[model samples]
Target chain A: MALSVQRCWNVGELSSDALRVAVAVSIEMNRDATPVADSIRLVRHSGESELLARQAFDTARRAIIRCGVNGFDLPAEKYGQWREIEMTFDPSNMRIK
Target chain B: MVRFLTLLAALWLMALPVQAQNGPLRITIDEGVIEPLPFAVPDFVAESAAAQQMAQQIARVVAADLTGTGLFREIPQDAFISQITSFNSPVQFADWRAINAQALIAGAVSMEGDGRVSVKFRLYDVFAGQEMGAGLQFDGTEQGWRRIAHKVADAVYSRITGEAPYFDSRVVFVAESGPKGERQKRLAVMDYDGANVQYLTDSRSIVLAPRFSPSGDRILYTSYETGFPRIHVLDVASVGRRVLENQPGTMSFSPRFSPDGQTVIYSLTQGGNTDIYRMPIAGGAPQRLTSAPSIETAPSFSPDGSQIVFESDRSGNQQLYIMPASGGEPRRISFGPGRYGTPVWSPRGDLIAFTKQSKGRFHIGVMRTDGSEERLLTASFLDEGPTWAPNGRVIMFTRETQGAGGQSSLYSVDITGRNLKRVRTETGASDPSWSPLQN
Candidate 1:
């Protein structure tokens, strides 16, 4: 799982490995199906204090791990060329980014 | 070539952020659209024939409590992609996700052996495809099903928001009726959502500003029972009450409890002059907190009890002032173009919510303790008496429409200045004081 996730960050690759990884996660969790972010972009809370910034980062990570429960539905045919998913997780507020 | 350069750019990005010094891609979200979290609450399953009617009603009440906040949107039953037939069945996360529901709720009702109603529920995070919290149950008299539902909603709200729940709390307020010139007021207490309203005092005499104690077991209000203004303390659970002190020469009004609930501060009027006075709740000699010729009333204590913020006319116009909990010199905090009154400190202790009147408009607003970052959440013909939810995320206040038919009602607004909603009350309610979370 670590190797697959790590390879997703390799540049210029178009393999749909990201989708396979997400689907594997979904079946492992006993989910019939789910919508996970195609990409997860970890971001920070700008102009906030250090404590607030740290909280923002933690909140973003929580959202990533939480919402990825069922997994993203990327195309299987494109699995071989897929790369890492980047999502915008803005943790300053309650709503999804 | 350009194509090769484009591929190189993509490769550059992929190779980047491997514990890079710059960190993740930087994005500034100063203000983002706040859409309510979508949730689905299927009607509670009836475990027995006696629980059939209550099963659906209880679920409706729970859904209403959450949707009323404008923080959770309920996907109507008609739009359901799948049904929850069995309460104990594992949830189909796919079905809920198809409907774009972030949260799903399932409950069941049964008749308990003790002749009471039993209600239990489980909350699931659909996208997460897992039960977010432990399932819990409540046993209560059948007639009190609404309270039980509120308890369930309170648990769900707390788990999702990571904040204290106000759904199970109560509100003490003044129920007003009749024409503006000949209005009748009564002291009343109701569930926070304005259900099961019980009147404690009739309209025989004018009553105003019913405030709940820290424990929510007692209420302090002013009444003209003896043809003069006097503060009365009432036991909430029982209908019994008594005058705080029968000061023959002075009138007392605008009472508030200290953080400890051991003392109260109110305004005392005598010889056409009004001043703020503090006294022990268990009965004691009154202590004077302010000595001035101007009228000083609506005194509220900071959450920490270290400071008192109240409205005063000492500056020639109505404005807010903060002073030490112990009697001392006062400092003015409001400088905006308006007359401010009824400054209530937030439970979070970070902001002070107040009622402001400016240019023929009244507004509910919040500002930092030191009088900074003032933001008005609502404005109307006559809005006043702002009260904070237990979590300090929302403020409920009185908004009275203009004209001869003007009637006062309760309304709430999130601190974000969005999701302004009118609270349901059986009668015209005013001066609402939200109680602390019940034990």
Candidate 2:
């Protein structure tokens, strides 16, 4: 699941200010591994500025919706185990500059 | 019976831990792809008959500005699954997503009876299925429609990238003509994208290194109008100029305005000794900043007016040094091999951009304020005189080709070493200084 999200995540779309912060998003998925519409939301952020936090959250939300359009590739038998997921997108290690 | 009930409650509490371990899965994603974001911009809807042509042109310019950044790729209209025929119409987010456009821009242009044009635009995040930010509108004259388009692009860029807007700014540069041996250089100002150029001075006398004031109201440049290199300040509005420093047997050039635009810091050469100096912009006795014996020139002030960065050969080779805004001992910030010159501090005050020469190639590079993490953005036969964009994310400089027929042209590169593009000009242009965003 992490690998699938990482593939769709475009960190380059984030601004420099947004890159300095980390955002955690909570998602509620249906039984088929497709994220429920309007269920992706930011749970927490590490920045003081609400603007930067929002920017980071928007990027994360876009990645989730973009990658989950066709549904995540997951085991349907373990649907109960992955119905609710928490994703923390941290860019500390990926800062090129 | 009470003892049995207590024992059963304790046993249930013990099982809670095992069940809690099966809670929702948590994942950390630290790696992500770095690629140009795909976007689509449909022709703006014309709200008036007179604005029909302006609407299409505005949309085209907006697309060009965003894609020119190299951080965005515009999806062709033919590939768009849905058409934006009306500004008030609802966006088909699913259609945009099917076409793989991560962002969408829709706008409208209207012309009032008083010869005023208004442009409004809204940016959308297709994948998120919502507007990225509140829609914005700009009003200007019909002649200034390009500026209006740039204003729209700036707002969209700032909202998406979380960076300040720079597209609404201007650049002052030296326009060149004739042969390399007898190049006629004149001072000219134009939009940041090299549109709507207006000449400030004639090419009869040679001019070099034109710098815009902090407020973009005046300009400082070096000219040989008096058979000697001297600094001059020209009013950007009236095009009237006067010699800044006229002491006999002394030369002054390479001038930059202080952060507050009240003082000018520059290089002055007297008795064959060159050093840095500062004086009032209204003409007064100059205060020498560096009394070093070696040549020192190309002085630029930090955004806060607390420090100044300049190039000097006091260390036996041309290198960058920072000193107090007032006179004081300077500290070297550049240690990499090869010679460095033309150091300009970034507007954000985090980095410094400079022109470096290594081996046989010249390059435009940027480093931290303390001269760390040096990265070259461009390498060519002759590249020099880097000026930062208003936002400091981009640097524009001069790139001269080799040979006798060689000509100088203006080029800008992203500080991240991407989007190196030649700016379009009517003639050979060089020594570009970008202006702050217009009010």
Candidate 3:
């Protein structure tokens, strides 16, 4: 339905040789659409690190969207749904150079 | 009749063998009139007799370099009361001071058996009656004498002015040729004095405003490589590059790195409107920082990263504004009568330099962080993109000449609006950014 993204600055000052990045994407899917694939990637300087931050993010996003669809008895689709997407920092994906 | 014959014979005799004295070389010394520091560079005398021509050539090159800056005037060789006959003897400073010279450049040239030329030059502050600095010697091929002279001049200029010498640095700019409608441009870099040029990119598409990163290892420029104006960062060391990511339905250009080299702040265009955006250097989605309806671009970060100075049209005309790094409402900082753009924060974080367009003319100007003390430094048909010197005392920018036959080149002006001089390039060049001294 709608997506929102936020950024963090001054992360370098916190650590000289390391950087921390987090992204939270909130999306609403159409009623007729089926959840097929989802991914969160943190990239910089031609390198990327991808992973799930917390298990609760996935559960809450799916739960809220499922609850918004078909009035709590939704199959895969019946009405549009709202989902919360979040990712966490992985040091391997971030480098000073 | 006998006395007249005797006088005529005496005159004829006086003119005959006296001609061997190399003709008194009558020379008029120009009077001091708030001109450049007057100095004399006598022809270098070689240690051995076989190196006469090379020695003279070296001194001539050094004299030319010093005079070209318009900051020094040279006394012609004919004005010299005595030719330099020995390099080992002490210099007669009083002789130069008698000619009202403020400074003197004296050197000796030598030739090695291997065909290399060695030159030793000394700069004297004639008024102080002291050698300004230690004498320097350079060894190079016969053809490198010109560069050796330039190096000597650079040293003398640095020692006298207390500013870094730019003569040794090279500038990279967009070289243009051909007609106005079908102009051909290529990325070219040349010596600071306009020599040793090498082209990096050819004009297959439009490229606008190429800027060197602080390290001089890369360049960020706006290019139409993908059939749309986009910002591309090129690695000067490797000639490799990559397109910066832009949000969907938006175009991005005007890229500059943060002082730490961790983020890039640039302008993103969407729906016929433009705003500023910052993204991580490693790679990530860009986050929009300004939501102004009018054009908001040329975002330069303060040296400490506490603030960002950018040009916005929110005031109904392009004006400079300062905003927090976290993105919030921007406060108006420029109240002048012109439209300002290309705001570049000074390296010292005390001033913001910009380009102001007014009355159909563009000018290079600077203002304080709070927008007070606005000073316009240069005005011309086209002058924009003020890049600060490493010490923040000078700014270099592009000056576009107009008319049936017009050209663009780089020029630098002191912060006080003095010392305006044309920066040389192989062809017509523009968009010069000075890099930090190499570590």
Candidate 4:
């Protein structure tokens, strides 16, 4: 069965390809979401399903890599079957310049 | 023949029930001071065996809450002179007035098989020799019998004093019990006189400044559970809650709802600077209201929602200021020597209650909206966070000690600096916000 996830995101621009890439990277890297700014903490509420979580991990992992975000680490794909998801992203140490 | 007629008239007069001859309606206030009516609350007469014990306990609690308000004095049963056998029994007005008790209370209690108890009470003006108001009855569970009694007392108080009664309300506060450094603070609420206490938040994280909604149904408070200061709204009935606007780097604290609960006004600290912000309860963009170099905390809305009074150090020292709810320039209202902060507008909209620090002593005081007639009500080692009673006649505040083993407790006083008393709590309590009377 597919997982259901509710996401809280920042005020950042995201194209469809970038969104796809982000989802893939998240699935591959096993991460939930990325921080867009110091003002926003994006949260994700997703259901259990190893395959779906893996897919989400892959998508988010790819997007962060393409965005050239340094120190962007994702969780493992095997731990994706969470009934509720909560994530906080910090931009204090990010090198955006 | 004459002797026989006199005997017949005496026998006819004996058939009528005896009542104190009614006197003229005399309601007068001499210099706005009426002697506290002396009232007696003997153990309530329980109609059933199930309520016999509970009825007496509830009656005592209700009596204490009323007596502590300073508007009434309990006539000790020892001096009651007359033992009331039934509610319908005649009251000897002369006997009550002889003891300087102008008012009397008599009640009956009954418990049903369904675990519900009913209380019926009446208030009589002894001097006027008549019932002053209508009789009242309340239904609740055995555990809530005390609250039912309080409601009856509050009704009598309002009818006699022409002011709303605060006895039936609840207070939300931080319940602390332990050493100073390792003290555990949990969000707890109890009846106004400190009974039926129930803890709402665990001691998992630091919680401060729990405020009741205008409707008295929800609580808005700040918690450091997520390793940062964030605001949370908890439903008092269901104990359900949701984090309010979880923005990173945004330290949200000091939340007070508007006169209407549509918007929550709180302080958000970002980049080491704190200012006031308003956010919808449903979670949306927080609109910044104040931009000042100094800290602007403790935002309280006026009764009409047109303005807000907050504490700010923009004048190089903390002082009270008033500003429009929409963005505008703030006008400083306090010019005292030491420092004034934590300005809470009264529900009556005539004055703002605040905490004033002067000469190493803190005091709870009040001033007119324009900062006139500043009256210091209580002086202590450390006093802060003045919350007003619904009627604006009394204020409840936190009193803290300043030492290695200092503790905090709640105390209340009248606006006129009369009737200062320590409010009882299950544990050391502080930051008491009196809730509005329940619907």
User: Which ten residues in a row are the worst by lDDT in model 4 chain B?
Assistant: B24-33
lDDT of 1 by residue, B1-439 (tens): 6765465456444544432243222222222233566789998999988888899999999999889877778999998888787789888888887887778999999986566999999998675567766899998888878889999998887666555678888898999989988999999988888888999999999999989999998999999998999999999988899899568988999999998999999999989899899999999899999999998989999999999999998988999999998879999999999899999999889889999999999999999888888999999999999999887878999999999999999999988687898889978889999999876
Q: Candidate 2 at residue B420, lDDT?
A: 97
DockQ of each: 0.08, 0.48, 0.00, 0.00
Question: Chain A structural similarity (TM-score) per candidate?
Answer: 0.38, 0.94, 0.25, 0.27
Per-model lDDT = 0.75, 0.90, 0.65, 0.71
The per-candidate count of clashes, in order, stands at 21, 0, 4, 25
Best by lDDT: 2
TM-score of each: 0.82, 0.95, 0.66, 0.75
Model 3 off-target regions past 4 Å? A1-97, B1-35, B43-70, B83-88, B108-120, B137-150, B246-248, B304-306, B324-329, B348-350, B403-405, B424-426, B437-439
Give the alpha carbon lDDT tens digit for every residue of B204-316 in model 4: 88889999999999999998888998999999999888899688877889999999988999999999999999988777888999998899999999999999999999889
Q: What lDDT is reached at residue B54 by model 3?
A: 75
Off by over 4 Å in 4: A1-97, B1-35
Model 3 chain B: lowest-lDDT 10 consecutive positions: B24-33
Q: Considering summed lDDT, which 10 consecutive residues are worst modelled in model 2 chain B?
A: B11-20
Off by over 4 Å in 1: A1-88, A92-97, B1-32
iRMSD, per candidate, in listed order: 13.9, 8.0, 38.3, 37.9
Error of 3 at B200 (Å): 1.0
Q: Taking the tens digit of each residue's C-alpha lDDT, what string does model 4 give over A1-97?
A: 0100111121111111122222211122223422232211122324143333333332232222222223222223422422122222221222111
The alpha-carbon deviation from the true structure for residue B231 of candidate 2, after best TM-score superposition, in angstroms, is 0.8
